[model samples]
Target: MRVRAESPGPSWADVGLAEPGHGWSGAVLAALLRRRGAAVLSHDTAAHLHGMPTPHAAAPSSLVHVTLPPGQRLRREGVAPHRRDLPAHHVGAVHGLRATTPERTWADLCTRGAPWTPEDLIAAGDHLLARPWSRRGRREPASTPEGLAAVVAALGGVPGIDAARRALAQVRVGSDSPLETRVRLDLIAAGLGEPILQFRLDAADPQCPEVDLYYADGAVALEYDGAHHLAREQQARDARRDRWLLARGVAPLRVTAEDHREACRRLVEVILGRRAAGHRIDPRPESTSQSGHDAPPAES
Candidate 1:
């Protein structure tokens, strides 16, 4: 029943009810498992199913990943099989296809041989815990920190367990993008202390802006301006936001892709300067707005 696929597209083979591709999707992987009826999707495959933040190195896989009960022999072609004991709760449906739970999938991704770095694993965890504005209009977190903690606690003597624990400690919910995660990590690595994620001033005031990274002690806020911040409309809006922050005596630092190399350095200077000046450095919005885009675009 091997044949080329057109709808889900090339590099795919149709094996009766299942269409497995080099980069087989979760639904396709689930279909393959349903045909086998004894295996559940796991590892990176399951991570994709759960919509976790994939690592930068991730590419389409040539084989579908599935886990079977211990002693179950699977001789299916195009399927990568592992013999493991999966709890019932850990096995569930994602996108109508049977796959490991988000927590289980995240844990598996942290294991040895999984193609993910510590940061990638942490970002995935953050994604799981984020309440993003999706098509569903404000989607709830797929998993919680407490749930992830329990999973890690219960899984003792597991392979890659140390890495999993390390990643868990770095995971923080409310990080809206990978850039935000990197900035947070970079600040800590640079001895700036941990910047709060999505920190807001005056919670009662809707006019008060929430920042990507907030240094409450120094009243300094840093924003990671990705591609979206480059638009003229967005630039104008950011200018207004900067003015608003300046009026409140908050030092707003906007980091664009260009500033990656010097961002931490510049940030340290600004924070120290503001601290030395005793937060009286600037109270006028007109004096603080930067020229050009919110964040300089990456070099061509």
Candidate 2:
């Protein structure tokens, strides 16, 4: 049934969770849930919003029980809104406004139990990884204001990213990172489309390059050109591969540490588009290699 916020006030429905930075949306929703009789758990009320579904709970619906303030009788719905101090970790923001950040939510999700399978967690990470940086205007990080918002935005979420981020921190990649995850949150906030990750090309071998990050159907392949590729033998092999693919019309975009951060979206677009529009660069096509009947080309 549709809940409303009314009565001496509007029906609880009118007080649903609001968009980030909405007008008293957070406060209103908080009150409405309390009215619903959702005995709010003291340690975590953002439970629903921050944590995962409690499949094992007897009453998954009532799993959330809020403890409302003494005089704020919730006449709207049966759910109750708990008014207790949130632990340090549970506090953060999402989509700009102050709410629970994804990282914190992940940690909280883990702490709660195995409500979500290991695959679920991995999928969630994959789901959120490609995200870009934050676009919301500055929210003071504590003291500094100029460029401080970026810092605050980075630190705004859960600590899980610290591990994920650190784990893949050293690995040189063109698009995302080692776990085959998506881009970091900060990249998403900066206004970017999630680039295709780990896509397969129709090459004879069809073996995807280990370092490929952003790939288009037939467009460019953005390879994070790390220090490893600088070795003489590796460089020679890469040059051959580049020439071979160029002959087949697949332009390879070598993104460096600097370029990946600065020109991510544009670089991805140009490569993808170029390949689509018949870029001169060639890529080795799968299942179309020369037939065995054709002898190797005579020595030039």
Candidate 3:
């Protein structure tokens, strides 16, 4: 089993040589390989050594996540170990170990770039959240919410402990159901007011209820629709849902992936005019997010 180095020091050769590739320690394993002129990647380099996955961007890998004590230096010239305080719950494990359980990994990446999604985050929770803290099972409840309201708010982006709290806020999962959570983050970043989530329409067609975004009281609905909505059957069903909504004297504002923030701005304008009886509304505009390090590995 792969294990953390117990209070490891840097040099391997100084400790004494083992037969062939045999007596080398982890540090020695890395150093002697460098001496032989082979390029090596450390940290979560090999697949699934720890929960952190293959990086999205193309930078050389380092044990960038495994923190070292302040004033300590890397033995290999120019190679640096990232230094951060170890989380309290990490017991019986060496500090500066080259891993951060999935949850901790996700928390570190949020909004700081390594590019993660709500779905990836939720999928990670299955292995990470509320688990035992043995050295082997290091995932923890660092960033998720225990309740729904907090889930939505945690959906708001922050860093470290705050980011963990935001991720926890809206913990609903499944390969299929990230709609509300996805839309909320998009809208907030776009500077639009938050909309009501999971609104349901009640009428004669109780057999097939529509998952709505806006309320008829002049409040607009915003759906976190994905490409799946464009599939033949889903599109037909959406058409029917729209017609039913129209018949009830409600005007439905539809948005697709191509037109997110602009569409939201128009809808909010409509809501202000229709719901508040011609009162002018000016919603703050949001800037778009940029591509980050975790763009997923390129096809070889």
- Top lDDT model: 1
Per-prediction TM-score to the true structure, in the order listed: 0.79, 0.32, 0.43
Q: List model 1 lDDT by residue over 1-300, tens digit each.
A: 232365453222332123323555534554576677878888766765566666756654566678899999777777778788888888888666788899888887788454688878877877787777666665777887777877777677787888878888888776777667766677777777766666666556677666777775577878889888889997887898788888888888997655556656777777777667776322123322221112212212
Instruction: Write the number of the candidate with greater lDDT, choosing between 1 and 2.
Output: 1
Whose lDDT is higher: candidate 2's or candidate 3's?
3
What would the per-residue lDDT of candidate 2 be over residues 1-300, giving only the tens digit for each residue? 333445334322444432221123444555444444422332133433433323322333433334444554443343434343344553454312234444444333433333443333433433333322245732221111112122224433544434333322221212233223223222233444334443334443443333344333445545556676799997987777676556655666666655535635666566546656765422344422211111111211
List the RMSD of every prediction in angstroms.
8.8, 18.5, 14.5
lDDT of 3 by residue, 11-123 (tens): 43443322221233455444433443222222332113233323323332433223344554445443434444434332122222334444444454443334345444443
Sort by lDDT, top down from the best: 1, 3, 2
Q: Which number leads on TM-score?
A: 1
Kindly report which residue pairs in candidate 3 clash with one another: 56-296, 143-164, 144-168, 145-168, 150-169, 151-169, 151-170, 154-166, 213-221, 214-221
Q: Which stretches of candidate 3 lie above 4 Å from their native place? A: 1-102, 110-144, 147-193, 203-205, 208-212, 261-263, 277-300
Local lDDT at 77 for model 1: 77
Model 1: pairs clashing at backbone N, Cα or C within 3 Å: 22-61
Give per-candidate clash totals: 1, 66, 10
| Candidate 2 TM-score over all chains jointly | 0.32
